[model samples]
Target chain A: MNHLTLALDTMGGDHGPHVTVPAALQALSVYANLHLILVGDRPTILTIMRQHRASESERLRILHAEQVVQMGDKPLHALRRLKHSSMRLALDLVANGQAHACVSAGNTGALMTMAKVVLKTLPGVDRPALVTALPTMTGDPVYLMDLGANASCDSQALFQFAVMGSVLAEQVAGKSNPRVALLNIGTEEIKGNDQVQQAARLLQSTPHINYTGYVEGDRIFSGEADVIVCDGFVGNVTLKTTEGIARLLMHQIAQSVKRNPLARCLSWLLKGRLKKLFLQMNPDHYNGASLLGLRHIVVKSHGNADELAFLRAVEEAMTEVQRQVPGKIEARLQSVLLEKSC
Target chain B: MNHLTLALDTMGGDHGPHVTVPAALQALSVYANLHLILVGDRPTILTIMRQHRASESERLRILHAEQVVQMGDKPLHALRRLKHSSMRLALDLVANGQAHACVSAGNTGALMTMAKVVLKTLPGVDRPALVTALPTMTGDPVYLMDLGANASCDSQALFQFAVMGSVLAEQVAGKSNPRVALLNIGTEEIKGNDQVQQAARLLQSTPHINYTGYVEGDRIFSGEADVIVCDGFVGNVTLKTTEGIARLLMHQIAQSVKRNPLARCLSWLLKGRLKKLFLQMNPDHYNGASLLGLRHIVVKSHGNADELAFLRAVEEAMTEVQRQVPGKIEARLQSVLLEKSC
Candidate 1:
């Protein structure tokens, strides 16, 4: 790849072009061989570029997107009506091969829907699952899929998710045949609802994948598994709960340290370690949500993403393009789904 | 409350009486109107009791329970076969009214099973739900009901759970007209599965609860509502996810902060706040899982609980007893169920 170009949705996220533009510039500086196709309001993009003292504004081309997708708008309505929305135009770039990959921090539903409609799922790919990487206790990040894409699921979809998630883990984490576990109420085969039970049966019999049986929500943090798979509903709930609890703890710690003189002394003792830990667990550190199993690479940034977070999403896109993740997923999924039909 | 005699299932947790004994003695000093009925292997309890020079030991009585419930043993098997288990005998005390409530950090299923068979559900209460209090962002604890008692729930059971949970919130959190929300995939009335949608419709039209419509799992910590009602399966998954995420973040924080000197310095500055936050978030501080809709109070302590956690369970029991929580729940439920019939 001489100079791979990624279409960055600059008008996306809570901070829009102000954050996305700077993050894109940072990525461009870090990777000299990378190019960016910035999609947003022309004036805002130019203003942000000027503020960054970016001379290579020519290298980062701005594509005017007259409309923007608001986070609160109905996903289907926004996708259907706002054809010129920054997120839609960015995704269209990938669909039409104008860019190597697409990254967006806009309305998640709209982005996913547009990507699915424009880029379409790989043949035999049942659902384009959203995968979020979370930092584990062992300092390695684990790939957790179906964070909020599909609320309801079937056995086949979950099995496919396992395959896609496993491939991503292997490529991203460099763990060959990473231990993949089906998130369930218990580790027993008999545990969980019909969807999980069916998925377990399919996963156990499926070859070419290392199935680690069921893993409870508690074990997700223990760094025991590399790839955790569950229905979208459970995955979404788990991810959000994790975020909420982290915030709650962080806030409480701040309150406690500021409360008393003795605590102040203790805080002084542990200051360096705590901030490092807090930063490590920061959501921005693992900001990208990969739209796995699609024909093209599409990473969803958090809706409220800042500059650093959007940059992380760009890095994710770069990594995916370098790894040819979509092609790998296509090959693995084809074999699995083809074998099932045979 | 004249010298309330309580049975501590000393051999119940992973660390057992080592933690439970010290915690109980500490609690004895704190709660002057408390007595002990230490139930476990006589020699072990005696050894631990001898270490603590607490004068309350004179009032301490040991009941030999040779068989203990293994954490991994099946719920019903432990309940039926382990007739001589300390956990069982502890429940026996409650069944016979010798003790007001029983606290154990043993197999949760066995505790629930034993409680149901022993104490029975309150009148008009079809099922006994498990309720756990999670720290909310609003600086108040939110009561999430049916955390895992029943895996599957119908519309009626969920509604009843809302009633029971709301009453507990009002009685416990002191929130009058405690806002009740049905946990769903989305906040919209039309956003969830058939079960959740039906529950939302019932909650919306129903007059008893201060229903706030549907709430996604993310909103649980947002503190937008006081009581969140969901089927046992969803609630259990959400609760475990919250726990798993908290543990994940804490482990990450500890590992990162301890790695370097500057990070350690930052950790020192944040240690007081961190400890306070972590301790507050510790399941131990809010260790009790109340058996709701039951005629009597039954709190499920963490199976791996230490002494401080068990002592907190005792305090929780005292709070319930002093507040007459069961009676209030019973009265509220009776009135609501009666209204439903009409």
Candidate 2:
């Protein structure tokens, strides 16, 4: 396997370097051909690295960033003021070809805005979509797109999202001729608003794309479709709702087990199997969300992700790097656009 | 409490008289003051009633309706051709003041259309919103609205939904001042589309409705807000996604328990508690979805709901009828509209 280099935004996310440095070291241990450039405050990064005995590793390096982008900072404000922040510097490494990809557990808006400005979008792509894999009953993950990147999208933008999402699933997930479906309230043709309806019409006409008409939210986990496309508003709400429900159910189960004596004993006996099952469905297991349609790869980890979760994001970025996802998307999109113009 | 008579469409839902008849009979047994008018084919209803030993009950009565509305029938078609259908007859009982409310597990579109045409909207309501209670961490259910009655809505329609939902929560759920929040992609003021943003502004200034800003989809289960309002498309997708996640998690847990010997043994020991927890989170436990803003109450059960689920719908309708929900909403909406006009 070829070497994959990732730029780590150490000063990002809730715990910053406390989580990122350990995650970076763990990723290095997992993949022998991996290298990481840690971007953050010099003293903080060095201290954490020394504590972890990580300085002796040849694959690890550090780049000091002058400023940090606070989680509460707006995208535009971060873009204008925090030019040398860790998040911006990490993406700069990807744009400047110093790394194969950039991974950040930072403010989603700031990371997206900075990556767009630094890496630019692929040709024939108007906007980048935040794409993430969600676990399905079939055991194969479904790639869901526009997970809060654009609050509102037009028909044309939704069309682009479908294109970008399909390409990502096909190229990265290695699903040939992936089935793509537009997310709607109902499966009927007359169900959604004009934007989704129009996008469906466009997808149906587009050649070389397996555009399944529409899939309702209830069918998302059924694994009937490989890629589910929607505007960011609907997509974000759907993803968050799924996460919230999972947490609520687990909490309820815990409470039930505690209240019953037999349940408590049974819980202890079934702890291993139950823990494995919980981990399989845990959101942290699928923490990385790729910023698709950018000229280079940039993966966004959850803001509150711990070391293990952040490492999963790094692995996600490495997979996209190996697959050459950005180039594949550009080629596919260009061909589709050419077909349309003709 | 005064006697509350409910008109149930015995021919509606997947199992028709099989489920609805049993459900109605079960409800009568639970509530002594409750009375039911079962409308469907007379012979089918009579057979089921006799089989259940329900014919001896004085509270149960049969209303003959020669025609039946198929689940696939469109609302307009059902209105035009199936005037005397069981579903239509049930709503008619409510419209003619013979019953306090109507309950059906029929086609949602047809039910909404027929009810709107027969009962009409309240003085100020422009459209009827679909409202249903969702289980929350606090054990108090949150009333979520516009589950799929209207595909699209303007700012004013959303405002009306908020007003209607707030009143329902206050009157039926007995919350003095329900904290109402607009469902959005983000909690920030500038997060959603123009319609939602506009609705938020309107709700913030509206008097008497405890307008807590925006709540994200993930926070809906957190039980922070009593009423969460959104357009039909978003609401429908959110509700379905939640149900899908719940089913997926439960399935996975069952699989995990089955796969391991110790886990299987433990599952049996904990079966009682686990069963109770699952039952609490089960969608069927909260089956009824009330069609608010109509002059009279109409509760829509899930089309595939079983006997127990259908009985829950009847219980939901009774709660609203006892609370005089429609009358309370009309009074509240009239006052809110009056305040707006002044």
Candidate 3:
């Protein structure tokens, strides 16, 4: 395999270098051909690296950044004032061809805005989308897109999301012809608003895409479709609601186990199985979401991700880098648009 | 307390009389002041009633209807052609003052359309929203509204939903001053579409509602706010996503426990505690959703609800009827509208 270099936004997440440095080292141990350019304040990165006894080898280097983008800062504010922030510097490395991809556990809005401005959008794409892979019952991951990049979308935008999402699944998920469906309240053609209905018509008539009909939210994890498309508002809310419910249920289980003496005693025996189950369902395991439709691979890690979660994000970026996801998306989108115009 | 009579559409859900009949009987046993009028095909309902050894009393009666609304039937089709259908007849009973409330586990769009046409909207209300109570970590349920009543809502529509939802929380949930917030991708005021921002501004300025700025989807179960408001599209997707994730997690736990011998043994010992926890988080416990802003109370049950789930819906409707939710909403909305106009 060829060498893959990823620009690390070392001062991005809540704990910054403390989390990113350990995660980067762990990822390096897994991928022998991996290279990293850590972007952050130089002294902090160096100190953490020394603590881990990781040296600047041929595959790893540190790039100094002067400022940081606070999680609370607005996207526009970060763009204007924090031009030299770790997040922006890392994105610049990818745009300048110095890194194969970039990974950041930072403010989502800021990362999206800066990445779009720096890397630019792919050909025939107006706005980029946040796409993530979720575990499903069939053991195949489903790719869900437009996870909050654009708040409100029209029929045309939704159509674009479908195209982008299908390309991602085909190239990255290794699905030959990924079935794509619109997310709606009901499965009927006349169920949702005019925008969704119009998008559905377009998808149905398109020959280049395997466009399935509507899929309701309750069936999202059933693995019935490879790609599920929706407007950003709906997608974001659906994603977060799923996370919230998972957390709530786990909490309930723990509380119940503690209250009963028999359950508490039994919990000790079931600890290993319970741990494995919780690990599979943990949101941390699914940390990184690809910023699709951009000119380069940009993976956004969850802001609160710890070392293991952040390592998963680095692995996600590495996979995208090896697959050349953006190039595939651009080529597919151009052909689809040309066919539509004809 | 005055006797609360409920008109139940026995031919509504997937199993029709099988689920609704037993659920109604169970509900009658729970509430002494409860009365039910079962409307469906006479022979089928009678057969089920006799099998359950339930005979008509002063509080429980049978209202036969010649036709039934198929679960897949369109709302407009049901309204135009199936005037005497069981679902339509139940709404009519509420409209004609024979029943204080109506409960149906039927097609949602059809039920909403028929309810609005028969009962009409309350004064100054343009659309009725679907509002349901969700269990929260704080042990108090948070009321979420517009869970698929109107798919695409404007700023004014969202404002109306907030008003109606607040009234429901206060009257039925028994909160004196409900803290209501708009559901958005982010908690920032500028995070969502223009309609949401405008609605937030209106909510903040309104005197009656305790309008908190914004609530993100993940924090919805945190119990930070008493009421969460959004368009039907977002609300529906969020609610369904929560259900899906809960189902997925439970399935994971069951599978993992079965795979390990120790875990399987522990699961048997922990069965009682696990059962209680599952019961509390069960979607069936939160089945009924009220159609707020309607002139009379109309509760919608899950189409797939079993006997216990349907019983919970009946209990929910009884709670609303005893609380006089619609009457309270009418009075509060009139004053709020008057205040807004001035």
Best by TM-score: 3
Q: Write the per-residue lDDT of candidate 2 for residues B210-303, one digit (tens) a residue.
A: 9999998779989999999998988888888876776676677787777778777777777766666655554634568999999998999888
Candidate 1 per-residue lDDT over residues B1-342, each given as its tens digit? 666767777788788888888888888888788877778888887788788764335566778899999888788798789989999998888788878777788887788888888888888778989887878777787888887788767888898899889988888778899999887766654465677778877777778889988777657778888988876766777777766766766666666667677666666666555555665554534567888877778777777666677888888877777777888888887787677789
| Model 1 alpha-carbon drift over 4 Å, by segment | A50-59, A261-276, A282-286, A338-342, B1-7, B21-37, B42-62, B152-155, B183-192, B213-219, B231-273
Clashing pairs in 2: none
TM-score per model over all chains: 0.89, 0.96, 0.96
DockQ of each: 0.45, 0.69, 0.69
Per-residue accuracy of model 3 over B183-273 as CA lDDT, tens digit each:
9999876798999999998888899889987888878888999999999999888888776665666677777778778777778777666
Instruction: Show pairs that collide, candidate 3.
Output: none
Query: If ranked by TM-score, best first, what sequence of candidates would result?
Result: 3, 2, 1
Residue A131 shift from truth in candidate 2, angstroms: 1.1
* Residue A192 displacement (Å), model 2: 2.1
How does each model score on lDDT? 0.80, 0.87, 0.86
Residue A13 CA error for candidate 2 (Å)?
0.7
Worst ten-residue run, lDDT, model 3 chain A? A277-286
Q: lDDT, candidate 2, residue B215?
A: 91
